[model samples]
Target: MLFIQRFVEFAHAFPEAPAIVDASSELSYGELYKQAQRLVEVIESTSSGSMIGVLMEKSVDYITSVLAIHLSGRTVVSLDRNYPVERLRQMVTSIDLSLCLLNEQEYDELNVMLDQGIRSLRIDKPTAPSADNDSVEIKPETLEEIPAYVVFTSGTTGQPKPVMVPYRSLSTLIDWMLKAPGRAGTTLLYAAQGFDVSFQEIYSALCYGDRLLVITDEQKKDMHELTREMVSAAVTRLFLPTSMLIPFVTFNLHDSQVLDDLQEVICAGEQLKINPVVRQWFKAHPQCQLINHYGPAETHVVMEHRLSSEPEDWPDLPPIGKITQASTAFLLDDHLQPVLQGNIGQLYIAGRSLALGYYGMSAQTAEKFVTHPQTYERMYNTGDICVLNEQALFEYKGRRDRQYKIRGYRVELKEIEIVVADSELVEDCLVVARQFGRTTTLVLYFTAQDRDQDLSMRLHTHLTTRLPDYMLPSFYKKISAIPLTPNGKVDLQKLPEVGGLRSLISTSYVEPHGELETTVCELAACCFGLDRLGANDNFMDVGANSITLISLLAELRYVLAYDFRQTDLFEYPTPRLLCATYQRSLDTTQQGAPTVVPASSRKQRLIAIQRFQEKKGG
Candidate 1:
């Protein structure tokens, strides 16, 4: 059966079920179904084969309008509400939007300056239906020219790349993977609607006999609130960014009782990296299924799937796991020769999961998505570096481009965090890189501050065993808190920004004086890849990130024989501050240099140290 028919069937079967709920507003399945058809009538009333833009959040209106566009025999382009006006305008102009699903607020904000005309929809009382279903006459066309939706992604070249998806693969995904179970219905947790992954996830979830829990971005961002809802609603099936699961589990998600009926936690896009905290938690709850998936937006669903039990073979390795049964994977070096088993290379996926091609980008579409070298069929150059092991599983390495490279080394930021998280000292940590023109540095940030001396020593002792020497960061700047973006991801931009000469010290940080402060500042400058070293500044507000902190810590310790812990760095965030503390300790010993240590009296020192330690422990 066709994909549209599948969507329509689910609507008919569960017309009375609740489809979408957020805040106080609630829309039943039947009510949403009619509202969607009303939008369809409004759409087909104008142009039969035109593309309509859905500029809404991940709510009932958004999900309903998607099928409405398909029902209207028109293409739909999912648009982000967070995008800047200029970028939104560019997308609207590019797609030649015939109709736009907008609230009254959006219409007031957008209608005046639109270059290409659009029919705005402010569904007054949203129940008011337009009596016109005669406009939609379904046409059968399997030609590659047909476009289901156009999704835009940020490309390396600083331009928006649209991946035009066809109904064939979209339908195949629903028919194959999105299955209905007896007595238990899946709740489709909607996230990333602007991205193609969410589009397919959402489409397939509702199309197959399932109850969709279409969520707003605001709900997902609130981990505590979202988990409460997830538990209350007994959400069995969920889709999310893999990066989120660990932290969400750490913060609010707990207990076997909260998710007793849950069978699958489907995750993708940053899923190859295994977080020890989440892994351990999942291990404790063996019955709850955890599915780690891999595939680009160009590919629908997943080309690869790793069940939780696959870890038996990966005691020393992290793998994205084996490709799906209907898909084929290739790991070829730069010269396109097949790499030896377990040798790293660029990944190329072929067979059913490969996308039709990028929309409006003929050259780019041809370059990356092309015919196989040996066969007549097509393949997509995944750009992700990986290795095909003897077990036939593809393990992810890192990105190939220089933008991903840091300090003349291929750094997998995720690997560093994974290892640190496994240490058990830190509840959570993140590594991020900042580049100032040609110079680059890594920063490491974690939730724990007062890691015991034993914890610090153990962390240092095991660095060589777990990570490669070059991959180890030079500086360690820790913060008591790690700021999160509105979407729950770490906000890298908020990290302290280092400047010339004084860039080594974290921005806004001030230190008690000693000769060691100067030396540590120099090391901080070098770790951050700054041409000049500074003596004063705080780290967090200055933009020193988690990855830079770890990278700098490794460089300083290996290069200089100082025994510093990743935990100590957080307590004393700036180079001047940490170095000053070290210098004072040496002076107290009355052995190293005879320099006068900066002192605010012994009583004040004790109080300061107590406060510092307290801040770090939390």
Candidate 2:
């Protein structure tokens, strides 16, 4: 059955039940159904047999447009309203879109940006059927045949590639989610509108007759505010990318009762690595089930692993677990033959949940979607390297291609290189993912004839127009030349490290010199669990979290009688900055005395250092 049909069934069964709860308002299933029907009427009047783009924020109107497009027997193409206008225009042109459904405020702007032939309808505004308007009827069989939605992923060629997901695949995903363990009374929709996982959050809640809480962008930006909303709304089931889950778990660990209603926490978008902090979090909250969900946009949620109890010794990385009944996964070697257990191979998936293929890219689609020679079944080459363990669970090794996930979003390194190459300032560039503890950041290396001081900044501003913020490299390093191998290929291994370069925090580094500087450096190293730390080492790069920062602040207060706010660690992350700021504070307390120490006071400086050391020894 189609997801829309299930929504219709639920609406009729529980009309007064709350279907969607946003920050400002709540919509019942009855009201949601009526609004969707009104949107269907608009679609029937303006277009037929074409994909409809829903460009809006996460709100009731956005949800209404999605349901309306599916109910009207057309595919829904999700367009992030936050994306640049040029990027949205490219997606529209690539999909050959003739009509787009948007909120009222975006109608004028999008109409001006899109081609003249394509029409924009305001789904947010209420519309009534005219006297001459005829009811458009779509058979259930026809709805089953049409694609449900289209989601775009980063392409190696620098263009956004769309994946056509059919209704059957979506239905299968929803069915599996309904049967999954820890099914709660309320599910939170926190993913971005354009992400495929958002569909799972929307449909699973409606299909299972659970309350759906839609998080607003304002609340999502602040973790403390978002946690309060979750507690107030009693959000029981949540799906978050691993990047977000780390902070959420950190918050829960600090309070231990921030999200008492959360029953199930599902993490996806990247590989799940169980760190010591995460393991400790699970042990503290044994009541909450932690699930590692693994899938691509081409096939939604094929494998999941659930841990109800904390293990004595956590694995380096979590297993993806057995394949669900809705789909099948095979680990095939280079020859497309199934690999034996305990051997590494590329993953190929075949099932009813497989996507229809990449939209409007036949050659690319053919390369990825291949048919089995003997079985005659179409399968998707997932490009993921995996191995089956003794228990037959798939353990994720790494990607077989250049594509990698940053903050739970699939990103292609070549895509960043392509955008960077477009800049006139760049001669050649290479982008690579750098891991700092649990966080992954993109670093770019470029070689240019002229090394202007502001060249990196200029290129960064230019790439923002062509790519999303996640695709932007966190650090840029300028090189005189790119090293090459004997085969004339780029020698990525020989590239210089970006460790000491200016990062997002500070423009330059200054070594610690004074006694206070030395003490702060030692304290920072102890807080971050490192034997030694440089004066320039970033706090975030060394796996510092809110809990660590709090502990460090408490220690500083006790040891040196320093009262620094928690925000100080974030604003002044490096030891040099922290020491300098503390000295400034001390000077201010001393009635604005000379800020700089006199060079002539060498004996006085030595005496002060001696007194400070004696105080510490006491």
Candidate 3:
């Protein structure tokens, strides 16, 4: 059955059952259906084209717009508002969207920024449908073959490639979720707007008649607030990216009750490593299951491994497990022949999980999606190296290409290099992914014709305006020349290791004064993987992301004996600004003001902070 049909059935069967919940309001099945139906009318009236662009932030209206587009028999082209306008415009032109549905704020801003030829309509309060208007009847067979949506992924040619997913591809996964026992529960829509898992969260839950909780951007960044929100909403199922697994589990170690109601945690986008903190999380919450899912955008979630054994016995890198019912995976050698078991080979996926193809890129599609000579079956070349274990489960090795998954987003190093080279700020450039423990950061090495002192800021601003934050390099190195091998190809091994705080730190080195400034510098340096930190150096300018900032916050709270918010890090980004502000607060405390840090605890914390600095600085 089509997902839309199943959604309609549930809406009729359980009118008042909660369908979607966000910070502002809750939409019951009946209300949600009415809203979607009303918007369907607006969608049909606006565009005769099958492809419609959805440019908005994650919200109730965004969800409603997606449903309405499907109901109107159109394909949704997700144009993430967080993405750079240049990137969005590229996608808009690539797909040739005739109409775009957007929030009022974005409708106004994008109308001026985007292609003016493309019609834009603001998604407002959907009104009651006309009395004479009848439901649009859609044949399941016809709908199954039609393109459900088009998602853009990073391409090697520097432009984003749009992959058209058919309804059958999604229906297969949704059907599996429906049939799976004990999986029905309230799920959280935690994935980003354009991520493939967002569809899984929205369709699987709603089609199964389970409530779907929407997490805000602010809540998603703060683990403590995210846990609290999940607990309050009674969210039983979560789709988390593997990159955040350790941090999320570690943040709730002492307060395990926040995870009590969670029955399932499906992790994807990278290899799942059962670290100490993750194993402990599972040990404390045995009732909850940890599932590692693996798939590319061309095929959404083709394999899953459920960790059923004791957490203590779990391997560091768990296998991706058996092929899902929706898809069939084959390990093939360079000659496209099937590899023997236990031998590493490139993975190729077939069956119902395969997408239609890359939109309007027939030549590129043929290059990746090939026809098997033996069986004449079509399969997508995943470009992922994997080996079959004795248990018949697939063990992920690494990528066959330069592509890397950073924070759940697929990144192509060549694309970043192309964009940088095109900017003309650099004579030549190379982009590489550098691993710092669990985090993988993009680092750009460039040689400019005449290096500017403000080159880093210029690159940041230029890249921010053309690419998404995830694609931007965390560190920029002004190299004298890019090393080349005898054959003239860039030598990967010869590239200098990104070192020293001076490369990223914009401010001149300034020694930290006072216990507070010293403590801040020490903690910042440790989290940022630097030997030392300057007092006036900005945290973000020195490559502090949300995950690192949270780690720094946790340490500061423990030593300072005061609750610090993520916002505090943003307000006082530099160590000097932060410490000076806190010192003034302490000064006010001396003048009979309420003190956030008690004098007694301040002295004790000073000793602990000094010990930490000594241990780390040593």
Candidate number with greatest TM-score: 3
lDDT of 1 at 189: 61
Give the 10-residue window scoring lowest on summed lDDT in candidate 1: 609-618
Segments in model 3 whose C-alpha atoms lie over 4 Å from true places? 125-129, 132-135, 179-184, 451-454, 499-523, 531-537, 554-562, 575-618
* lDDT against the true structure, each candidate: 0.59, 0.76, 0.81
User: Candidate 2: which stretches are off by over 4 Å?
Assistant: 129-138, 179-184, 311-313, 452-454, 500-508, 511-618
Q: In candidate 1, which residue ranges exceed 4 Å CA deviation?
A: 25-29, 125-145, 253-256, 310-317, 335-340, 402-618
lDDT score for residue 396 of model 3: 95
Clashes per candidate, residues 3 or more apart or on different chains: 42, 0, 0
As a whole number from 0 to 100, the lDDT of residue 164 in candidate 1 is 74
- Per-candidate RMSD, Å: 15.3, 8.1, 4.4
- Model 3: pairs clashing at backbone N, Cα or C within 3 Å: none
Q: Tens digit of lDDT per residue, candidate 3, span 290-334?
A: 999998999998998999999989987899989999678889999
For each candidate, what TM-score against the reference? 0.66, 0.83, 0.89
